[model samples]
Target: MNFEYMKNFMDSLTEWIIPGNSVVIYKDGKKVFEYSSGYSDLEKKIKKTGEEQLYIYSCSKVATVTAALQLYEQGKFLLSDPLYEYLPEFKKMYVKDGDRIKAAENPITIRDLFTMTAGLSYATNTPAFEKARKLTDGKMDTRTVIKCLAEEPLLFEPGARWNYSLCHDVLAVLAEVVSGMRFSEYMKKNIFEPLDMNNSYYHTPNDVIISPQYIYEIQDTKNIVELQQKEHTTGVVKRAYGNELVFGENYDSGGAGIITTVDDYAKFAAALANSGTGLNNNRILSSATVKLMKTNQLNEAQRKTMNWRRLRGYGYGLGVRTLIDKAESGSNSSIGEIGWGGAAGATIIADTEEKVALFYAHHMLNPQEEYYQPRLRNVLYSCL
Candidate 1:
């Protein structure tokens, strides 16, 4: 692959984008390109390395889903199984209408959570979610927060519509209950260890120094500001060495918690791209299971319900976004490319058809990542 243009782009990140960034691309289970630029801590003058860990945010969802599927492969639960079976708090949930609350027509199923159709919204301005947040205002336990989420009314009836939400957070608790292990423990044993992803974790290690996070501000058009520490009520907390909420004693968030480095994440991405086999020749997931994960699982209505602009030509899969139409997506990626991104400009795309896996990590909190992500895809796929 021609990496001249890619190298130029990486070099420009510190000047044009964020202070530090890393990119890694793998093809056929081998590293084809890898690059890092700028400092992990600009104030401290620490250069970024392949081992510098950063919070992956929502990208952690795919790992949680992969762990859940391992249990599914073992016949522990079915996609159609009602969530109430695992967490009885969801036995009789309700939905909040304009001014009234009504009983949900059906119970939320495991598949509904995977497809974002469970009507569970994130902590938002809505009355229901606001109340949900209050339940765990100063707490860190995953089961406690999830049960509180269940007590809150849904935004819509289960399976009636799709909404990006805290459904995966609940899935984390379900995985723990089903696997008879902690969420992080299950991931380490079944996913990270097998793939040799030594730098991935639900919590930042106590001894390792991590890259500092930043936020691009419109007020300072030419400079990025270091993100200050703040209390977060959404069950996730932003910290210097990655996020702190997932580090709670009993909380292992599935939606947005895992921290990893470029090479470590590439290992996970390569396994997905290579039919669930890691570079070490260990099977992290069955090939059939990976195929199912990459397949579009949403129906027409659910597809229509997606609110994110970047999901225009994509469809919801188990955990990642599956490219259903290359032309409509306005990119050169082949159909069936599956991946997800974090809020802090971290993204991973695994194209099974091209046998390519691409990962980009930057510690800048930029909502405009939609622009850069596809740009990266277009550049990489064009070279191919």
Candidate 2:
């Protein structure tokens, strides 16, 4: 497969919007291509190598679901089991009606968490979150915070629609409860240790050298020229930590809390791409379960809620986007291309059918996924 076109496309991204970026591609459990472009620190003129550790933000969801699915493989829980069976705090859930909150007509099920149909909300400023903070003295422990989250009402009835919320975070705490380990611990023993992903973690390692991330301050989207200017795009990312989503040292943010290098995450991606088998020939999941993970879990009405620009012609699968329509997505890739992205320009694409996987990332907060994600998929497939 020729990667010249992929290189050119990545180069253009550096020239225009992306400050710096890197990508890793694996075919049949082998690293076939890896490249980097642009500057990690634009003001310092530091070239961005593909090895820089990055905060993968929401890409953590992919790992969260994988970790939880490990427990599923052990017959720990069923998809249709009521969520309250594991987390007693959710025994009674409330839903936000038009003008007032009311008791939820349906109970949330384990499947709802996997499919983003649990009606949970991503809003962190809710009274429940604040209560969690005060109760834990800002430690925001996964179980504590999630239990407090149950105090808030859901956005809709469970299984009614898809909403990108704290569903994965809820799922993470469930994994912790089932395994009798902290969310981070469970991930380490099951997902990271088995896959040999030593660099991936819930907390940023003190020794790993990471580039100072940046944010593209959009002066005004109406004025497109400003978006291309250096002053508008390059600034030290103001966050105090590697990931703002990680509320405290004890908090394992299942939604937006993974710090790892491109290759580190690519190992996980490649495992899924190769039908849950890693490069070392260790199987993390059965091929049958991997197929279920990528299968579209959204129905027609539920799909209507997954109307993000980048997710056109796709259906929400088990914590990932499963491609169902190539024409609608304008993609050349196969129909079941499954993966997810992060807030700061991390994209995961795994095609189990083709035994290929890709992890592409730029350490910028506002990486334009709408423009780059679909095109990157199309371009990579073109090269193949």
Candidate 3:
């Protein structure tokens, strides 16, 4: 792999692209390139390094999905099984009909959760989601939050549309209920330990120093503001940073809460790229399962209904985004590339067609600048 273009990319981060950032690329189950730039903690003068950990946001969904698939391999539950079978609270769900609410025509299934067609949403404007925010209030655990979500009225009929929602968190709850283990415990045993992702955690450990999160405001475009204390957001019941956030008595957000280093996440990505085998020689998932996870589960109509900005060339997979038409999507990635990103600027992409895994981690909050992932992918693929 070429280093010249990557060097220039890292230099741009130092030039105030988005505070500090790190990138790791693995090809053929081996590290081909790695780079880190700026400070992990600007106020503390801590330089970013391979060891630094950042919140992975929605990327955690991929890991959660992996755990569910492992359970699937064991015949724990079928994707077609009604979600109400696992969690009774989801039974008899309602949908908003004009200004009133009515019973849903059909029950939501586990596959609906995986494909994000459950009609559940995270939109704060909706009364249901607003209630969800108040119900969680950083106090309820994952299962409790899921129960609260089930009580809310869905935006549409199950499988009628696609919306990025708290479906994964519900899936995490299902994993817990079926496995009879805490969500984190199941993941630690089935995924993390097997793959040797030592630095990855559902909650930050006490000994681990979390890289400070930064918020880039429009007024201070060049200046990245560091958050001193952990900030809580709506529908999420944990802090945004630090040990209290991770180890705190709160929800295990299968959708958003994970802390990991670029190197560690690259290992997870490499495992996906290598067809379910990790660098440590452990098979965390079966090849058939990995193939299923990376396959596009959405139809063309469902793809047209997705609202995410970065999903132009992609379709919903079990948990990650699978590239379906690179030309139509205008993405430089391979057609089978699978990955997801965090609310912060972090992203990971595993391309089995090219035998490449790429990860980029940063702590900037709600980055208002132009999207960086496509540019980064184009540059990296060009180097290859």
- The C-alpha RMSD in Å for every predicted model, in order, reads 5.3, 1.8, 5.5
Residue 259, model 3: lDDT of: 82
List the candidate 3 regions with Cα displacement exceeding 4 Å. 123-138, 219-248, 368-370
C-alpha positional error of residue 326 in candidate 2 after TM-score superposition, expressed in Å:
1.5
Local distance difference test values of all predictions, in order: 0.80, 0.87, 0.79
- lDDT tens readout by residue for model 2, 1-384: 999999999998888867788999998878999999988777778898877878999999999999899899999999999999999999999999999999998999999999999999889877987898899998888889999988898999999988889999899999989989999988888888888998888786777766677776663563435455545345435344467788888989888888888989999999999888898888888999989998999899999989988899999888899999988887788899999999889999999888899999988877777778988998999888
Show where candidate 2 strays beyond 4 Å: 222-241
Give the per-residue lDDT digits (tens) of candidate 3, residues 73-173: 99999999999998999889999999999999999999999989999886535454445557767465777667766778899999898888888888989
**Model 2: residue 38 alpha-carbon error in angstroms:** 0.9
Candidate 1, residue 63: lDDT: 86
Model 2: how far is 3 from its true place, Å?
A: 0.3
Query: Which ten contiguous residues of candidate 3 have the minimum total lDDT?
Result: 228-237
Model 2 Cα shift for residue 314 (angstroms): 0.6
Winner of 1 and 2 under TM-score? 2
